[model samples]
Target: MTMKIKKILLTTDFSDYAHYALTYAVEFADKFKAEIGLLHVIEPIIAPTDFTWESYDIAELEKKSREYTQESLDKIIREKIPDKIKATPIIRYGRSFEEIIRCAKEEEFDIIIMSTHGLTGISHILFGSTAEKVVRKSPVPVLTVRDPEHKFEML
Candidate 1:
């Protein structure tokens, strides 16, 4: 059977695992003639009590996030993806899994690819695996990469 993928959503945390996933995402997109959407979701930062509404700086945070996202996007576009594949970068603020789901639904992407830290011990307890939650909750297929093994295929 022939497989055709038009759009793909890739979520990244700018980690090493995520960089590996990005490589796979780019290759898959190229092979399928798909458009890629790269998303980075910033988990909400809780401020101290002393930091009131006036002290809160949403704009600055947003600006920093956008700059970082763009830097990441530029790096990937330059080093990872080939000229044949087209991709867009997106930055959002909120829970990671929720933002991923929302972007997938709203963007109507055919595939979702991301990376997992494969965290254990205290780290796992503190920050739940976004990749795990995404795989469980995503209505569409989710391709998560941890190690650099196995060939990537669309499900």
Candidate 2:
């Protein structure tokens, strides 16, 4: 039996590294004749509890940030994605991995395609890989693409 994919979730962090996944996602979508849901998750800013964070206008900042992100998402679809392929712009506010999984489940996407930055050491410890977390927990299939520029060297 052949697999049938109708909808695809393409996750991006708006980075050069994340752009790599677009190629793979497009190929898959083209093969499956699927629509692409371009998703971008905005992580909430964590302010220090003791630093008088209330003085800052975080709500306004977040609103502007979301607006900016939406524009960027649309731009990507308009420029990178093919006209023949249907694409939707999706933006979520919360943890990156959590939002991705939740959106995929809620939208009933056939598969999730995203780029992995291959974080290591302290950087990895501080901000864990979102792609890795999604792969571990997502009930749906996840396809992760690594940065083409990064090469694993023998230690």
Candidate 3:
């Protein structure tokens, strides 16, 4: 069966694993001639001090983070993707899953492609996988890249 994926949203944490997912997302987008939306979520840094606002330079940190992520995203597209692909890079601040879902809805994305952290033991229990939560909560189809050797699947 054939699927119509006109708009695809790919979320990245700017990690190597996310780069893998981005590669797959780009290949799929190119195959379908879909518009790609690249999103990077900056997880808020909660301060322990009572006067949290003063403790951290939130604006400067956020600015740096956004700039770094945008550069990385731009580099990936420039180095790996063809000139014909339509894409945009979006930087947002919030919980990863929430921001991803919000962007997907706001951008009218037909699909979401992201990489699973594949955490184990305490880390997995303490911080649940964002990819898993996104799959459960996403209104549209969510594609998660987990297995290191598995091929990308289109749903």
Candidate 4:
């Protein structure tokens, strides 16, 4: 059966693994002639110190952080994505997997392509795997890419 993949959501953590996955995402997009949605989810940093008018301070911090993030996103599009394929940068603040799933559903993307950290043992138990969660929860198909060159070895 032929699948109509008009839109593809590409997620990244700016890691080498994610950048490696971009190669696959780009190949898929080119083959399907689909537009690419580049998604980067940033979790808010919670400070331990208590402060007056925390919201204001947090808002200011968020603004500056987002500005740099948007530029990073734009740079990725300009440097990595080809001229033939259409790409857009999307930034969302929240849990990575949740935002990825939410964006895929809200934007009606055909699939989500991302890199897996392949976390194991303690790291896996403590942090869990974002790609795994997205695969299980996403409303659309998920393509998880692993960078064969990078491996996490336990000390």
Question: What are the TM-scores, per candidate, against the unseen true structure?
Answer: 0.81, 0.90, 0.83, 0.86
Question: Which regions of candidate 2 fall more than 4 Å away from where they truly are?
Answer: 49-55, 118-123
> For model 1, where is the 10-residue window of minimal lDDT?
116-125
Which segments of candidate 4 are over 4 A away from where they belong?
A: 50-56, 118-124, 150-155
1-155 per-residue lDDT for model 3 (tens digits): 98999999988776768878888888898899998888888778666666757857867877787788889879877786677998887888898889999999988899999988632347567778888789899999998887487677799
All-Cα superposition RMSD per candidate: 5.1, 2.2, 4.6, 3.6
Rank by lDDT (best first): 2, 4, 3, 1
Residue-level error in angstroms, candidate 2, position 43? 0.6
Query: Which residue pairs in candidate 4 have backbone atoms (N, alpha carbon, C) closer than 3 angstroms, thus clashing?
Result: none
Q: Largest lDDT belongs to which candidate?
A: 2
**Candidate 2 vs 4: which has more TM-score:** 2
Worst 10 residues of 4 by lDDT: 117-126
Task: List, in order, the clash count of every candidate structure.
Answer: 0, 0, 0, 0
lDDT of 3 at 140: 95
Highest-TM-score candidate? 2
What is the TM-score ranking, best to worst? 2, 4, 3, 1
Clashing pairs in 2: none
